[model samples]
Target chain A: MSVTSLASQLQGLAPADGSYADLFSSVLPAVIDAIGEIASSLSTAHRVALAGTANTFGDDQLNVDVAAELVLRNTLAAKCPSVVTASSEEDPVEKPVHSEAAAVATRPEHCYTVAFDPLDGSSIIAPNWTVGTILGIWEGPTAVGQPAEKQIAAVLGVYGPRTTAVVAIRLPGSSKADAASSICLEIGLGQGQQASQNSEVLRSSVRLAAPPFKTRYFAPANLRAAAQDGRYMALVSNYIQQGYTLRYSGGLVPDVVHALVKGHGVYVSPVTAQSKAKLRQLFELFPIALIVECAGGLAIDPADGSRILDRVLQGTDERAGLVCGTAEDVEAVKKALLA
Target chain B: MSVTSLASQLQGLAPADGSYADLFSSVLPAVIDAIGEIASSLSTAHRVALAGTANTFGDDQLNVDVAAELVLRNTLAAKCPSVVTASSEEDPVEKPVHSEAAAVATRPEHCYTVAFDPLDGSSIIAPNWTVGTILGIWEGPTAVGQPAEKQIAAVLGVYGPRTTAVVAIRLPGSSKADAASSICLEIGLGQGQQASQNSEVLRSSVRLAAPPFKTRYFAPANLRAAAQDGRYMALVSNYIQQGYTLRYSGGLVPDVVHALVKGHGVYVSPVTAQSKAKLRQLFELFPIALIVECAGGLAIDPADGSRILDRVLQGTDERAGLVCGTAEDVEAVKKALLA
Candidate 1:
């Protein structure tokens, strides 16, 4: 069966001005290519061995994690010249990718900053469960200090039985009316194709089911926080009593992406005094928030019910709790945890 | 880059008399091939649509489930003439596959009964999460009235980011010394290969981590049972307080397979008066129990802590709860719930 290429899908979503179109066209496919390479290696290599070092977040690095970070970083630097700054969860600091002469030669509007969590579920990878890569692209030289709304596009690469991506494109400064045109698509990559062959988009235009969902699902991250926070415990108990099907895989990307794929789910990563929020804003939560919102869902800070996109980024490593997914379910989470 | 074929791996483990080896050689690859067909179709097909029919178990049947059942049943019947009886979770009844004359011509000792849950996680499939197939092969006309130990072989097909299978073989009536020779191997099927190509074994001899696991993980199936039983709730509470990582995926095969793949996990599906046991023994629990036990972990009836392998099956539709994984975690569960 004929399938739409991701490049064409991005082209179709390009604005009249075609702003950031060329950058996304070049960067998103390269990111998928990097993921395809990692997926191939994972199928053939020793994945669970320790790399004997920790990321900047102090999480011990797996060999696959370290290798994936390098593959993605190198792929972007070599293939996407428009990326001026690259921030990775493994390194946790924004590194200037473009030379000084190139930076001055290109206008700031033409440059983009890409913050990514390469291999987000390293802890769960050994079990051969699904893990993923997350990329958030911001217009300009850096993602820091800008509100998430400034992000032009985001890509979530899922490494499961198939290598697929959820790509969300929102033109910078799009009006509320244009929100309807903002596209969040799930595309398959290199499915039924050889590893050496160029990545192919096998499926396109994947979206969540329309709201007022019939079946309820929940992925409660940071369940350990329930031990300390009575409110959190009550919320979990309420979900259990209400018979919400549990789908947590101890991975941020798979848990959140499950909500998008299944059409209805609430993924709660709440923070208490003891269980501090661990998801980074620029590297993890922001990209996921944009994808969720573009898919006609909601992503908000659990602390105060504010839209996550409305928050200004403070640093690359800034962390916060998130309650995101189907609109009604997100509201239910807010009512249970806050009200 | 050369990988071993699953056929060869099974052949290598064949006893001197080749008892049940030929049957396994025929049935396992056919199952994996059927899974490959399902996996490839899932990449391109409209998967979330319903067939508008309910299985004998009263669960709504997805189109994929119906297709998968046909594919697996047909593959087994066409490829393995030794399989005299086939039972499916969707149909939930034993049906003769071979002609009466063919069955009468063949020795009863050579014939087998296969009970399987084709497409085990239909509820979780819409989200593109991992689902699987579970198969148990008994040595006679039926699996009923036989202890799980009478089962000569079992196979689990995981349809996740990849299509893979865990094949376990234990010779019927083997001595205690031969118990050490029982095999549970995880083999990748058609990975990085064409759909028409034969299944390949990317890895072999997958085993659980040696016990006394340092890190604890739990997949609490039937979490709603916690609401009805205080003991179940307390057991869950203890796991939370002790900071066991959560990895439940609301799918039996993926949850149990996660334990084997990760080397340490306890999967609990407990029955209460309100939340009665739902897992079918002949199709779901027995095959998984055999695989877990073959992998050096333990599978037990959550009610009485008896070895699941010791229980004699009374019928095809028998239901029970399971607590299987690393020995220490299983003990912890039995203690918290039964002590």
Candidate 2:
């Protein structure tokens, strides 16, 4: 599809997750802290204020929480990921001034935020904060139930963020030696716009899904988050018990975008993906296949690896499925289910 | 204006003080019990779970204390008001039903819910559930500095169920002796839909600002306990003196709905209300006014006592303002402001 068509298609795809996963995920860690901060604010707000009991959330409390949560998200994104860019309520990203002074060279890969709401339903009244979340994204899923491991042996091999997980993609022009910058980088595509060779680069070092696998789906929305979830696999069913999370937020763009920046991939429901042939219809099979392979992962039909999208596009009806974890995880599920 | 149009016009336009006053008054009694129950629940929940160091809410060792205060708005709304509803997540308004026929119609006027937020912050996270809401909702705005006499002496004074206050407009066939049942009958339109001769109700409430006012705005989204809090005429806002609530949720419907139902009127901002006029906008005004007026409270411009959508055409701007207390309290605010 043309860039405009692709962008439109993606926008029409409903963020792959519902409402705003990024919005929620991005704000979670700070939200965690804000609960405490606001609690303090409320407590010390007054000692001699009221003679008796009055039930209410003083105005001062709300403002404190909102401001605190915003700061936490921004601060975490800057440090945790390489190219942490986002479109949130607080600030919009402005196009950087095109400085042609140091031109002629390949654009640097940028780091951005990749997030999944580690916590959902974290709300409480006057007293305490409820719920928790992790929003940064990453490369691939790991074995189920294993604590996220750290990169260096000395440091625990943790996959997601302490508060959130992150995700991003590697760029053709980027080099393996470009790991000096604290933040990762990425080339952000417009809503639904197909990624291109000329797009900016970002961190693609950590593959989101661990048990990398080749996969295919027919649902449009699920396909988006699965593909963007970085695992090229959705954190669909937790059957495999991998460390990677298969999230559902009820939107396509935000979910995918979230996964993209965090190095995770987006996903679609197997049923929706196959009925509309959404994934194949949107992405050229070979190129998408190549991209998934290039990202050091595998892709296949969630039902059965043998019945790949290229192999059996017309014969399937039971299409709802997941797209996450390592190749082994996908292969295991496919082996277990595909008839 | 026709009921439909009236409901539509008065949707967001609240007698700011009215709602505030109502919430404060209603919650006081409910709070007394809510705290008592949570003290038991937290202790039991922790005991049941057997988590270590998780201090039970009822314990005396902890210095946790919960109170609501109203501040700032005294100058802004004339009557310093803060709205609070304390109850368990369970709905308030319990009623004994004899048969299926009455059961359906007897859908309790309220549900019990303890939104007792932590008295402190993460400072209290050590006990986890230590900081949460104790449900309480009052229906009117008694002076913030008044004695507890007002809360205990209200028309609708039940603490077990969630509603700190329940608003009811007598039906064409109802009588004064059946006010509670009549009010229960109108729970659907109990907020501000049906008008009764001399029947005034207290909707939900909020809190915000610095010190002095006993109410504060914890932002409705976070004010879970308040959703079920309500009382009539004898409003709380009694004990905590910090400030009044300024509930805002960036316009999420359910959260706002809860506030409207439990509030004397709903409070929203210009962008949130999504209109240039506060009372005129349909989306912003209808739902809120329906809540406030149907319950017998007035739906006037918080700033000017001129009826909000009461303008002949009921057209107003989206600069959605605070839904003050009961008609009396609202007038007091305008009077204070004008004075």
lDDT of 1 by residue, A1-339 (tens): 225555665566667777777655677767777777776666544323212211122266667777888888788777778888898888888888767786677645577888998888776554456778889988887888887777878888877655667888885567321247587766656643232133443334445566465667889898888888778888888888888778898777888877776667889988888878888888888899888888878888998888888888988889889999887788888887886
Candidate 2, A1-339: lDDT as tens digits: 134332232233223444322222332223233223322233222121121123443222333334434544544433222223222212222112223332223242432322222222222221112222223222222111211110000000001101111222222223221133112222211111112211221232433344232222111233333332323232322321232322222222223323322333434334323233333211122112223333443445554453222332221122224343234444544543342
Give the 10-residue window scoring lowest on summed lDDT in candidate 1 chain B. Answer: B49-58
Q: Local distance difference test, per candidate? A: 0.74, 0.27
Q: Give the TM-score of candidate 1.
A: 0.85
On a 0 to 100 scale, what is the lDDT of residue A122 in model 2? Answer: 20
Error of 2 at A245 (Å): 14
TM-scores for all predictions: 0.85, 0.26
Query: Scored by Cα lDDT, where does model 1 land?
Result: 0.74
Best by DockQ: 1
What fraction of native interface contacts does model 2 preserve? 0.01
Task: Give the candidate number with the greatest lDDT.
Answer: 1
